[model samples]
Target: MATIDLTSDAFEKTVTADGIVMVDFWAEWCGPCKAFGPVYEAASEKNPDITFAKIDTEAQQEIAGALEIRSIPTLMIFRDGIQLFSQPGALPGHALDDLIDQVKAIDMDEVRAEIAKQTDEPSDAD
Candidate 1:
């Protein structure tokens, strides 16, 4: 599958609100980014149900800044408006595939339970 060109203005709609959107933060001059390109594309093709996008750090500085993308070829996974994972460095084809599979297998009910636990904590002053 071809990489979706993501711009600063389109980040929210494309990745945030979209279901299971994976954004690859990279730059044209980064060697690791170039190496990971094919792996990212192949995974995208294999998973049509998920949206895959790429944000060029050089071209989309604002988006990169907002996401605090400090390294090239960072992969950020956002599911249903929540950021599930963000990692830097290049991943092998199989590794990338495994990452996607793991994310898809996550139990959303458990995820929500964890979120509730964090939010339900009482103040310490009491």
Candidate 2:
């Protein structure tokens, strides 16, 4: 799939709508984000099953704030509305491809169970 631009309003709906969603948080001024752009776009074409989305932090400050994006070219992945992975830095094409493989290989059932466990556990705030 081609990389789609995401606004704050569309972020939630796109993430929750289907299978895997990968978001690239970026800013036009960042050099690393520029380098990673084609790599991310290529990965999107190679893995058409996944949703590849981009958020321009400069334009979508509200969404970026909500996600607490600390750096440019931060990558986030979500599956079934559950965020699976997030990281900062520019990945080379090979590394990004490897990451895609890893994401595809994950067992969502176990992920869900872990999420439930974490939520069920008492917080220190209590």
Candidate 3:
């Protein structure tokens, strides 16, 4: 599948859907973002099962601000509506492939349980 452009209106629905969703936060003016574009697009084609999307920081400032994105070419991965990975920098093709493998290997049952535990715990503020 090809990468899709994500806008503010579609951001929440797209990321919260089932299956794996990879989001690339980028800007037109950023050198790193330009360099990473092709890498990300190629990965999208390689991983047809995953939803690969991009948010142009310059055009989608609202979404960027809401996500607290401070850097260009920030990559975030979500699986079954749960975010699994987020980091700055452009990943090499090999590293991106490795990351996809790791995300696929994750046991979401364990992840959900962990989330439940954290949410159930008493807060330090209390």
Candidate 4:
């Protein structure tokens, strides 16, 4: 699948939907970002089921600021609207592929159970 360009308008829908999303925060001029572009694009093509988005830090400064993107080429992975992992810097294609594999390997049922446990608190009176 093709990568969608992220902006203030599309950011919410793209990141918050139910499924896996991988967002790359980058700038055109950043050398490392440029180097990682092809790898990111290839990954998106390989994983059509996962939503892949790229936010140009220069064009979408507000979004960048909101996400606290301190460095170029920051990759954040979200599953079911919740952030699962985040990292900064340029990574090789293999490393990124491995990361994706690891994320996919997560047992979502366990995660949901954990969330339910945390939120299922007893009343204070008890």
Candidate 5:
């Protein structure tokens, strides 16, 4: 239930885990990132079922670059190995909680069908 620091090696396995994973991409020098830290931590304790991880942008340059984290506080949510949400900014505790609720309520079966449809669609290059 405690928030874990994520390194490049831990990133993949953490996100690809079987359940909800919330990752906060942040840096110590960032004001917003600092402000959001406690809020994120509080949520982590409340939502024990979700894996809460933080990636320090300064230390984990490779992982930050790979993810194209242009901002200090980027929030990403992964469920069942599918990245359902990615947003750049700090979220208030209430808003973050609301988002978690929304993500949990998603119809993954429809989402999977939509992904399949998009993948199966022919390209326009022809």
Candidate 6:
């Protein structure tokens, strides 16, 4: 599947949807973002089951700000409404593939449990 462009209006709904979603935050003026665009597109074709979405930082500044994206070509992976991975910098094709594999291999049940435990624990500030 080809990547879909995301705006602030759609960002929440798209990332919160079930299944895996890969969001690429980029800008037209960034060289690395240009280089990584094709790699991201290729991965989308290869992984048809996943949702590949792009947020043009120039056009969607609000969303970028909300996500605290300080760099172009930032990649974020979300699964089952939870963020599993977030990193800045462009990834090569092989690295992107490896990342997809790692995300796929994650045991979400364990992740949920870990989140639950953290939330249940009392905060040091309390």
Ranking by lDDT: 6, 3, 2, 5, 4, 1
Error of 1 at 67 (Å): 1.5
- The sequence of per-residue lDDT tens digits that candidate 5 reaches over residues 71-124 is 879999999889999999999999999999998899888988999999999988
Model 6 agreement with the true structure over 18-70: per-residue lDDT tens digits: 99999999999999999999999999999999999999999999999989999
Q: Of models 2 and 5, which has the larger lDDT? A: 2
After superposition, candidate 3 runs with Cα above 4 Å error:
124-126
**Regions of candidate 1 where Cα sits further than 4 Å from its true position:** 123-126
lDDT of each: 0.89, 0.94, 0.94, 0.91, 0.93, 0.96
RMSD of 2: 1.5
TM-score each candidate: 0.91, 0.93, 0.95, 0.88, 0.95, 0.96
TM-score attained by model 4: 0.88
Which residue pairs does candidate 2 place in steric collision? Answer: none
How does candidate 5 score on lDDT?
A: 0.93
Best by TM-score: 6
Which stretches in model 4 have alpha-carbon errors above 4 Å?
A: 118-126
Model 1 poorest ten-residue lDDT run: 10-19
Better of 1 and 4 by lDDT: 4
Candidate 3 Cα deviation (angstroms), residue 118: 1.3
**Inter-residue clash pairs, candidate 6:** none
